[model samples]
Target chain A: MICVENISKSFNGRAVLRDVSLEMQEGETLAIIGRSGSGKSVLMKHAIGLLQPDKGRVLVDGIDIGRISYRELRTVRRQFGVLFQGGALFDSMSAFDNVAFPIRTFTDSTEQQVRDRVLRCLDLVNLSDVGTKRPSELSGGMIKRVALARAVALEPRYILYDEPTSGLDPHTSTTINNLIKGLADQLDVTSGER
Target chain B: MAALEQRLIRPLYSLGRYALLLSKGFTSLGHFSVYRKNLIVQCGRVGIDSIPIVALAAAFSGAVTTVQTAYQLVSPFIPPSVIGAVVVPSLILELGAIVTGFILAGRVGARIAAELGTMRVTEQIDALEAMGLNSIGYLIVPRIMAGIIMFPVLYVTAVLVGVGGGLAAAVATDVVSTGEFIRGARENYLVFGPMFGLIKSFVFGFVITSISCYMGYYTEGGAEGVGRSTTQAAVISCVYILLSDLVLALVLL
Candidate 1:
């Protein structure tokens, strides 16, 4: 479970999050709905240990994320996956390499194992045939799915989606929403919490 | 009275921030290899691409040094051999260090600042941070490592090019025989002097890389910000390299 306790973040003396507190249990799909500049991204960043609160703490599975060292933070980060709004794919790498990045960086998997795992993740996102394409060549929905595949490449216990359906058509958005629902259900079955 | 306090306190706060940044940069060295591939790319861009200009500058500097020394040696009390001695020491101590540093400021320093400043503006650095990676380790450490390794190698190349230019000037003017000039150069080849040049190059590399990275990292705005950062990196690296060279010469010489 991830718990945020009275988290307050300010920039240049202006408060963005004012004593915000929340808890996310295992296997739960909690959609953060807010208008523009509603601090939705900041809240997500804080929850995932990407940003620190000025006046509170964020605990990921009983570990205080903000105060831990970077080395320890990596371990915590390994349990969570983030699909950025912009995809954030390394432009220099192919889709296959992009999906395999986290596995290569954090795991001791052999090259063949990494390749097989990346292919499996790509298959889950229904992008099995686009592994050789760059992010620039993909359509909006395709890029998002590739990014999602990269995010879940490590088989993370938790996943954070930032405007995953923001730029797509309604039909594509529904497809993405269905994928999110399915993944959340899988998490529930595996973790027995959420 | 309150305004005076604010003025003094603001600079103190800036200084504190600079100190904190330096400490963070030093601590980040252990994770330098994370960006090794990027560093290799950057080194090729900065060092190898700029070799033609560096060689041109070194050649002209060598010719000018030869001319000046030859003119000054016309005194009855001064032997012509003293010209090589004077040029050798000056080249190793001042010309070698300062010229190479200036070249790097124009080439490598500006490139680093502009590239990183673009990355900063484009939110790439923020993306790396959001992934729980240390930005310093992911970006600056590799550049620093590359600068330190490559600067000395470039300085040696500069020395060879400069000497070849001096030989060319000598042949053109017939001021000294080729054999005589070569003999004089061989006699004045002090190992310690070139060692000083090597040390200066290393120090200059640190200055260039640190100042460029700092300017790039703190850049704001957009294209204009990147341009300003590049200019600042080049200017600050050149100034710091010259100042550090003087200090090292005083201590080592």
Candidate 2:
């Protein structure tokens, strides 16, 4: 479970989030809908400990995020899968390797096991053919799907999506929405979307 | 008072930030297994890719030094072999490493800054952190490792090519025969000369890579910020290289 309690944040002394509170429980899909610049992403970042709140605190699985050391925070973060607004794919790597990155970094799986898992992830995202392509070669929607494949490679317990469907066409948007919903249902994981 | 603060306080603040980044990079070490492939890739990028330009700069510097030395020592009593003696020591002790450093300050340093700055702007670094990876250890360590390992390799290349270029120039100019030039260099050769040069190259490599990584890692804004960081990395690396060169010369020589 992720708990954000009365968190306030300011940038350059200008208030962005003021006394915000939210809770995402196990196997729940909670979407924070707001207009642009409404601090939805900021609140999400605080929940993940990517940004520290000016006031109040965030708790992940009962451990205070702000109080924990970076090492501990990393341990907590491993349980999360975050898809950024821009996909944030490593441009140098092909889509397959990008998805395989976390798996290789954190696991001691053999080459065959890694290849199988990467293919399965790509298949989940409907990007099986584009695995060999670099991010620059992939379209916006494709990049997001590849990034989603990467995010979910570790089977994270909590998945966060920041503008996941933004910049996508209507058909692609529906596909992404269905994919997120399906994944949440299939994985039985809590999801927070901004 | 504002100007004074900008001059003194701002630099101190920047220095503090640099030191902090370096400390964090060192402390949050990643597993060797994770970074091994990257280290090899970075070694190829930083060392092997730079050979052509380093060789070109080193060759010209050596050839010019040989010709100039021969021209300056025009005394009838002084043999032409003096040109080789002067050229060899100059190339070994100072010119080879310094020239290679300045070249890499622009080449490797700016490239690292630009690449990392792009990653920063594009949120790749943040993505790495969000993935529970130490972004510093993953990204910066291999580049710095490559720099320290490769810069000395480039230095050796520079000295060898520089000496060969000097010999070629000497033969072409008829300033000294090949035999006399080799004899002159052999007579003046001290083991400390190459040692000092290697030490200088190693330090230059660290300065260039670390400063570039720092500038790139903390980059802000967007495209403009990346451009600014790349320029700053090159400029700062060059400045540090020259400063360290002076210090090394004073202390070692």
Candidate 3:
């Protein structure tokens, strides 16, 4: 569970989020609907401790995240999977390596295990054939799908999608939406926050 | 009043942020293998790739110095050997060092700033942070390490090439006999001459690379911002090089 209490955030003294409050419980498929520049992403970013609110507290489970040490914050962050509006995939890395990055960072998984998991995640996202491609080589839709494959590579407890369906054609968007739903059911994800 | 405060306080804020980033780069080393790989890559970028430009600039500058020194200082009263003595020390202590510093301040500094600024604007840095990675340890430290390690080496190479050019110029112009020039070069050579150049360049490398990294790492806006940061990195690095040159000269000379 995550709780945002009276959160307020501003940039250059201009408030973006004002007195916002919300709670998200486990196993919930939450959708944040707002027009562009309506602070939807900003609010979602604060919920995961990515962007701290200037006033008010974010409680991940029961712990006030801002008060904790960086080590603790990082540990808390491991539970989250975020697909930024832009693919935010490492342009320098191949698709396979990007998906394998989190596993390499956090787990003592063997090379074979890492490869198997990466391939499986790519298969899940239907980007299995383009594992060797760099982000630049992939189309915009391909990049987003590859980024989504990377986000779920770790089997994160909560997945945050920022505009996952924003730029895709109807077919591609539907495909992505179905994958999001299928992955939640198959992985038994505790929370699918969009 | 606001503009005045901003002018004064902005630097302080930037200084605080720079120091914070430096501290993170020093302390939060994520993995040794990752750091080693990044360091090697950055070393190639800063050192191996910069040789041609540094050599070319220093060579011409050294040649001009030799010609000018011979023209001005040559008389029956002063020995031709004095040209060698003056040129060698000048190249080792200031000419070669400052020339190499300037090259790196523009080239490596802009490259670092542009690369990092692009990463920041493209959300790569944020992605690293979101993935529970120490972005500073991953990005800034390797570039900083490369700068500190390579600057002195490039300086040495620059000084040697420059002095060689000076010697060639002297020989061509009949400014000084080969024997007289060599004798004077050996005669006035102090242990501190090369040391001063090496030390100054070593610090210069850090200043150029780190300032550029800081500027890029915190960059905002977008493509235009990357362009602005790149220009700022080159300009600021050059200014800092001149300032450091003055301080090093006052202390060492």
> Which residue pairs does candidate 1 place in steric collision?
A26-A193, A26-A194, A27-A194, A28-A194
TM-score of each: 0.85, 0.97, 0.95
The TM-score between candidate 3 and the true structure equals 0.95
- Highest lDDT scorer: 2
**lDDT of candidate 2?**
0.93
Chain A TM-scores, candidates in order: 0.93, 0.99, 0.96
Measured by DockQ, the strongest candidate is 2
Off by over 4 Å in 2: B1-7
**A1-194: candidate 2 lDDT, tens digit per residue:** 88889999999789999998888899999999999999988888888888999999999999999998888899999999999999999999999999999999999999899999999999999989998899999999999999999989999999999999999999999999999999998888899998
Report the lDDT tens digits of candidate 3 across residue range B1-253: 9999999999999999999999978886766876787799999999999999999988888789989999899999999999889888889989888899889988999999999999998888877777777888889999999999999888988888888898999999998988898888899998998889889988899899999999999888999999999999999999999999999889878
Whose TM-score is higher: candidate 1's or candidate 2's? 2
What is the docking quality class of candidate 3? medium
Per-residue lDDT over A1-194 for candidate 1, one digit per residue giving the tens place of the 0 to 100 score: 98889999987788889998888887777777888777887888887676788999999889999888876786677687788776777666799988987787667899999999999999888999999998889998998889888877877788888888897999989998888877777644112111
DockQ of each model against the real complex?
0.32, 0.81, 0.60
lDDT of 1: 0.79
All candidates: CA RMSD (Å)? 3.7, 1.3, 1.7
Shares of reference contacts reproduced by the candidates, in order, are 0.22, 0.68, 0.41
- Per-model chain B TM-scores are 0.89, 0.97, 0.97
Considering TM-score, where higher is better, how would the candidates rank from best to worst? 2, 3, 1
